[model samples]
Each structure stands twice: as C-alpha cells, then as structure tokens.
Target: MTKVDILAFGVHPDDVELGCSGTIIASVQQGKKVAIVDLTQGELGTRGTVETRYKEAADAARIMGVDWRENLKMEDGFFQINEANIRKVITAIRKYQPEIILCNALEDRHPDHGRSSQLVEEAAFMSGLRKIETSLDGVAQDAWRPKYVFHYIQDRYLKPDFVFDISAHMQQKIAAVQAYTTQFYTTQTADDEPQTYISTPDFLETVKARALMLGKRIGVRYAEGYLTKKMVGVTDFNSFVQETT
Candidate 1:
C-alpha cells in the first residue's frame, strides 16, 4: 500500500494549488511524502473542461513533487457531507494513513468549500472508529486517523489557528497554480466567454497579496495559513522558526 506523510483534499481541481501549494511544497522539500485528493473534477468551472482540468491538476502535482494524486469524481456543486461521501473519504484515510491531512477552509465564499471541509473533518474522525467499517478493494481495512487535520484558508478571510512560513516556497506555489492554464488569466481566453471573478489577472495578484499579507502578519515574506478544529500544542519550540519582518 502507498503511504504518505501528508494528504490534501480540495473541493475543486485547483483549490489545493490556490490555498496551500506553498506549504505542500515545503513539506515535500523537507522529505515528507505528500499527496492530493481532488474531490471534484471542476467540470462546472467557467474556463475549463474536465479533461483539461485533469491535465492541469497533474501538472501542478508534478510541480509540487507530490507522490500521488487522485480525483474522487464527486459532483462539483451537489455533493453532500452525508454518509456516502464520508465513507469515500474514509477509504482514502485508511488507505494511505497520512500523518497530516489538509483540507479546504471550514468557511469560505464558495459553499462547497465549507461543506467539503466539514465532510473531510467528520470522515477523518469516523475513520478512527473501528465500529464504522470501510473497505478497500473488497477487503476490510483497519481504522486509522491522521495526527492532525489542517484547513487551508481560501476566498474569505478567516482567522488562522497557525500559519506556515512559506517565504522560500512562494514562487514555486505560484508556478504550481499557474499550471492550471485553463482556469486563470491568459491572453487566449476568448473575450466573448464572459470573464468571471477568478479569470482576471488582477484576481491572481490578489491571491498573491493575500498570502503576502498573512505572511507579513507573522513577519514572513510569504506564508499559507490554516485553521484547526481544536487547539494544537507543540512540545518543543524547535519546530517553529520565528521571522521578524
């Protein structure tokens, strides 16, 4: 079975790149195995087809140097935090048994993002209950929960529980997000297609600015912030490197 140190889940194909690519890349650079699971193919997105988004997601994964990537094929706008989807997430939680699981913001502009966050949160907990059975390839799997689940901030500003210093990895994060050529600003994205809020160049810059502001708060050049369901305690201060802006 393939094992990973971190597993990130996105409500849509490019959410992971937009939200936490910096942190993901940083973890991989530190030799931690990382993977991404896109819950939807983003077929409903204004700019790209599902096939195109799939290719883009793969390219982003390559840019980030992740070990594996998977798409759950869930309905983009219609999926619920019900049992079926929860069980699907549980299957993956047991499959790789990652040390950390990163998911979309618990509250965001996109309703799906918030719902997915709760779905993943509950499923992670359910995965640890031996009574809640989940199987992989017809074989019963043992219950396993990750050490931590971090929700990456996106769209709307929510107070972060902690922020990761991603100054060195910022450019790489931008590069990974740019891999989704079909989704963001491009000279070729027909003027007649009716540009949405995210298809413009200015919005992309805002994404960068958001990261910069969050980084500035913690005295870093760039960083990605996350919120946890419960308080996180670090046994040693060695785990953090304070940066003074």
Candidate 2:
C-alpha cells in the first residue's frame, strides 16, 4: 500500500493546477506525502487531446512534487455516481490510505467538477464500511477512510472554511498551471488556436489575482481557500496560523 498524507482528486487534468497546486506545493515542501488522482482524462476538452493532457498532468505533478498520479479513465462530462464509479474512487482511497482528501469544489462552473466532487465525497464515507468490498489487481483491499475531505474553491467563489497560505510557492503554482500550454495561454500560443474561458491570458491573470485576494484575507501574499462540511477542531491556538497585524 502506498500510504500518503494527502490525496487530491480532480475531475480534469488541469483542475488540480487551477484550484490547489499552491497548497499541494506547500504540503510537499513540508515533507508531507501527496498524490493526485484525476477522475477523467479530459478528453472532452476543446483545446487538448487525451495524450496531451496526460503529458501536461505529468508535468504538473512533477512541478507540485506529488509522489505519483493516476487517472481513473472515467467518462469525461458523463460519468455517473454509481456502484462502479464509487468503487473505483473507494479503491483509490483505500490504496493511498491518506489522512486528508482534497477534491474539487462542491459547486463549480464545470458540471463535471461538482459531479466528481459529490462522487468522491460519497466514496470517502463509504470507504470506511467494512462490508463495502473493494479490490485492486484482483487482491482484496481493506476499507480505509480519510480524516477530512476538503473541497478546493475553483471557478465558483463561495465562502471558505479556511485558507492555506502558499506565499512561498505561488510561483511554483503558476508554473504548474502553465504546464498545460495547450489548455492555457502561453507565450507560445498560436494565433489560430481557439480561445476558451481558461485559455486566455486574462484568465491566468485572474488566477493569480484570486490567490492574492485569498491571501489578503489572511494577511499573506498568496493562499488557497477550501470548503468542508465537517467542523474543524484544533487542540490549541498555537497550531493556528497567526495573522500579521
């Protein structure tokens, strides 16, 4: 079993990069083991092919310093939250055995993001049931559940339960996002290439501004916000991130 401290789930290859690469980079720098799971290959994306997404995802994973990444090959924009899909998610959760799970926002601009979020959330809970049998490579796997499931705010702006400071790794996060040159605007972008919502330079600028805005709320230079249904508890105030007054 490849145990990890955190497992991040994204519906598309670049979803993780756009949403929480800064946090992922911060965690890696803190010596925490992290892995990324993309629920789909992003074949339906207008700007890139499945093969291109695979390459971009690998590049981003390397930039974030995640231990490893795997794509579930779920149908892009059409995967259902049923027994098969849930089992696949459960198997991954069991295999990684992470204490924390980071997933897409509960609601986002892309329907796939919200759908995948619900699927992952449900799977995380069901993974704890001993009777819910799951296996990988024909071997029976043990039921495993994460301590927390936090949704990274992506396209839609909702109130966050907490914000993670990633000031030190903000540049790294941008690099990760730029890895998908075909999906996002870059210096090398062709004039003939079709521009979509995320493929524009302005969108990238907004990404940076969003991080800065979130950081401002916490008196930091850069940060990522997250939402969670469960209450967060702390043993002491000493563990909290003190804001600079």
The top-ranked prediction according to lDDT is 2
Model 2 RMSD to the real structure?
Answer: 0.9
TM-score of each: 0.96, 0.98
Clashing pairs in 2: none
Please provide, for model 2 over 1-245, each residue's C-alpha lDDT reduced to its tens digit, 9 standing for 90 to 100: 89999999999999999998999999999999999999999998988789989999999999999978999999998999999999999999999999999999999889998999999999999999999998889989999989999999998888899999999999999999999989998896656767899899899999999999999998888889999999999889887677797
Model 1, residue pairs in steric clash: none
Candidate 1 ranges with C-alpha deviation above 4 Å: 187-192
Model 1 residue 52 CA deviation (Å) reads 0.4
Residue 155 displacement (Å), model 2: 0.8
lDDT, candidate 2, equals 0.93
Candidate 1 residues 1-245, lDDT tens each?
47899999999999999999999999999999998999988988988789989998999999999979999999999998888999999998898889899999999999999999999999999999999998888889999989899999999999898899889998899888888877787565556666788888998899899999998888889888999977898899878867764
